[model samples]
Target chain A: MMQRRPMIGLALMAVASCIAVAARLLVVRTLDGSLVVGWPGPTLGQFRVDAVLVACSAGAALGASGAILQTLLRNPLASPFVLGVTSGAGAGVAFASLAASIAGMAAPTGAALGAPALAGALLALGCVLLLSRRHGALDPITLILGGVIVGAIASAGSTVAEALLPPERRGLLTGWLFGRIPEVPDMGSLAACAAAALGLTGLGAAWGNRLDGAALSDDEARSIGIALGPMRTAMFIGCGVATAATVALCGPIAFVGLLAPHCARALVGARNRILVPAAAVAGAGLLTAADALRQWIDIGGGRLPLGAVTAVFGGVAFLVLLRRTAAGWMA
Target chain B: MSALRFQSPIIARGAFMFAPGEVAPSAGRVTVLIGPNGGGKTTALRAAAGMLAPEQGAILLDGAPVHTMPAAQRAARMALVAQRPEVGAPFSVRDVVALGRVLRPASPERIAHALARSGLTQLADRPFHALSGGQQQRVAVARAFAQHEPGGVLLLDEAFAAVDPPEAAALVREIRAEAAAGATVLAATHDLSVASALADDVWCIAGGRSTAFGAARELLTRAALPSLLGVAVAEAHGSRGTIAVADYGGILPEAPR
Candidate 1:
């Protein structure tokens, strides 16, 4: 187990990001829904607090998933979304919605989507892993290609199922598909997401040394006494489960997973032990910041959707980071 | 003393199987496996390293089954320098070498010592990927050296291939030093000249079967190797007589030459 300095660094970063997010969300809102700096007394609502927790947990889950996926696939570009896990969850939710409509019921949200979403995500992950095996080992490029194909297939299925949903239910599906950062979350869903995030982050941190060794080729890793099968299986499944829980709570936030590790890697070195926690915390920070900014960037128009805010800002940041990363590698 | 024995056939991917064999390279000695490409040398080394499990027989490391040992324990007892080590990220050279002590707390002294031995001390802070192919191979050797316990086994798969001649010579010296310090070393190579210079014992393997040949001095010669190596062999005498001599030249026509 890694001690002291690195763990302290991770803890400090996590706290800083959390504090910054809370500061932003704790402001007072005017009559027209514009937020401004305000004192504490009667201003703080439980809804805002829940939103903060949701962003943090969802972001951390995606970030941890991205870190492990990148290490396992041996590609810096790998992420939970890259493997189409989120799309599989979407497809599961879509099918469940269709089923609900057939039985004359409203489509369930939040915690209710957890089981089906997890099943679909794991199924898609298994299919990708199965298809990616070459000469009895998983090839990184092949895994990416497999993920793309499987994700596309899952998305197509979701679309087909969505088309069959009732009119009112269709609107709910569409809204969820745009992605969410719900102020009022189902308590059970929030608990699951938080648990998944903590578990995945801890797992990544504990298996840090093995994850580092895994960056080498399978034969090299095996020769060093690192069993490739169990390590890969555990990490990949942990990533899948965490990602499914995230999708269930947040409906599929983007870029936090893909970008968080890069941010963390820039701060911490490529060692997975520190990198995993740093990435998870970095993700929490990114999503929390995005949520904070979502609150700030308001005019007479309605508040910017959390999904749109994250996509626009995170996409630009990723491009800039990508250039820097490419230059670093070249250097 | 260390003995690696495959008492039965070992199956690998493709149409490959190690013919039943036994080769015991004692402690404080350099044992070389000399053979043609696609022969069972690498397969045999992998089996000995416990990377491959036997289909019919047991791979024993000094009477104890190798494949049955817990992976970490097996790794602690042995170190392997693979033919081509694939590293994904741009880790520093020292970081790569330090990975050898994955089970133990990293010792800077050990890493530095291994680097010096492998002639890689100057490249310690450099990114592993930035190094040339030969340098990378040296790094792999250094990693194995860092992991090696004095009395433990060191297995090298094609330890001399693709490296520059000078580096390869340096590596031979380093390997010899390791053997002198009581490590049992088994190295596989198609480089017959290096084998002549480095080995105390030779196992000539071909056509998927391994045979325990005699001493490297007696076996690594034009007269002895042509029939065993499936290629024409040539002798080049050096200052140390046979140390820097005897390399294969070309294929032998089945018809009388």
Candidate 2:
């Protein structure tokens, strides 16, 4: 029976991935009746495909990162966004764009955006770690509070940068800030994000047993041969990198990271091996479906932001999960 | 079984310091550590298990310093069951037990045997948090048992405190069986009767120091119990056995340094 759970979860993940792909294809079919052959210019179908790819990759990254973050922090609500990685990345890009504009330079693009974003993420992570540590231990309440403070500061900085931008460019910046999926104009950036997400997810899954042991008391985990310091450091860095990559490509889409892991935990148990990948697939399916829904809504001249769609669903899921938690549904 | 030797002064944060001492747990024997609350008993056990590094001297397993050895290698040679081990997630009893196998190769037979020995076969499918405190302690015992290596060292800190008598007796039997099979088993407990009945050797700790180390029957005397526990103690002898009872003296003042 124990062995069967992982197998079932694996099957569910496969189905979810297929559904995500189908959802993307469905969006493409709706946008353009069929696939366009040669490209003199980017077709509507091509644009939809890029959106789907970015959403799925970003979703997968957030899901995997959330699983690790939750385990490390020992808090069910911990995720990339809640922990400030997304806001930090947003600040980094905004600061870089502001600097470039002041120097009368064209805005940074592609891989150029990654360095500053990663720096900002690591900085926020450091602050969270430092502020939350008390008597050589990480207190959950302090950690969350620290993350919130860092996020707020970074958000304010990003807002200030937006105010400095030219009026014509303000709409585009605001759209990104609201967590709209970016069109991956270049294949190179897409490949880089995809590779990063997959690589980090593999690393997280490989450490599953240690992660399980880590859920125990620090003394017990140490007695059981887990190098707690190294394991935690690795998890933090892996989650940070994955979150930064996603935030750099797509604006900080809230809730996919927080919601997917909880959904996976319901499907499978709390074992990190199954939970990590299952969450990844769930996130992919969720974001892909959300993007499709966004396209379907078409409320105004532009489609609704993918982030807004996910937040609504994710917000509702969060409340329900919180209620169940309050009633002692989780340990 | 491998001999465990602690030759050091161990220090635990927010706790008393263990003065320099040497503990030579005999091979194939059940060595029990008895002490008053906060007497550094847990600190000693943790040092022996390699969870706490000594500020001075060393803990040696098979004559090699445990702190110097690789973590996995050290863990392969011993298992420590903590008092009130944390169950932070909704893991099944079997899953919690399986965590013990991290240092060794996976073996279903070994896991099954451990569960049966701890009498947890019936509760293997239950979530750990759903179990009673005593049941949770038993699950910890099962996990340590599953992780046992041939002639390995097992250190348990108040592992059976929450368990009822019958189940505690069964666990004691399991510990004896392990010792007879050549494992060095060291346990800490406040229950002097259980310690005296099962231990081949007893180490009495008081005021963060080892006050006595010898045969359990000889060391756990009525005269020693009162001073060690800082209260009045009475030993009642019946046809069944001898039980040492202590009277609460309204929390005796801290022992003078």
**DockQ of every model listed?**
0.40, 0.43
Q: Tell me the tens digit of each residue's lDDT in model 2 across A1-331.
A: 7779777976887697777666665543234334322323457556767877887788889998888777777667778776677778778878887888889888776556766776777687777777777646566567779889998998898899878987655544455566766665446656766877797678878888888888777777777888776677667667777787777677678889988888788888788888888888778788888877776674545567777898888899889878865544235
RMSD of 1: 4.5
Model 2 pairs in collision: none
After superposition on all CA atoms, what RMSD does each candidate show versus the true structure?
Answer: 4.5, 5.2
**Cα error of candidate 1 at position B9, Å:** 3.0
How well does candidate 2 reproduce the true complex, by DockQ? Answer: 0.43
CAPRI tier for the interface of model 1: acceptable
Please report, as a residue range, the 10-residue window in candidate 1 chain A with the lowest summed lDDT: A322-331
Q: How large a fraction of the reference contact set does each model reproduce?
A: 0.48, 0.53
**Candidate 2 chain B — worst ten consecutive residues by lDDT sum?**
B238-247
lDDT of 2 at A49: 74
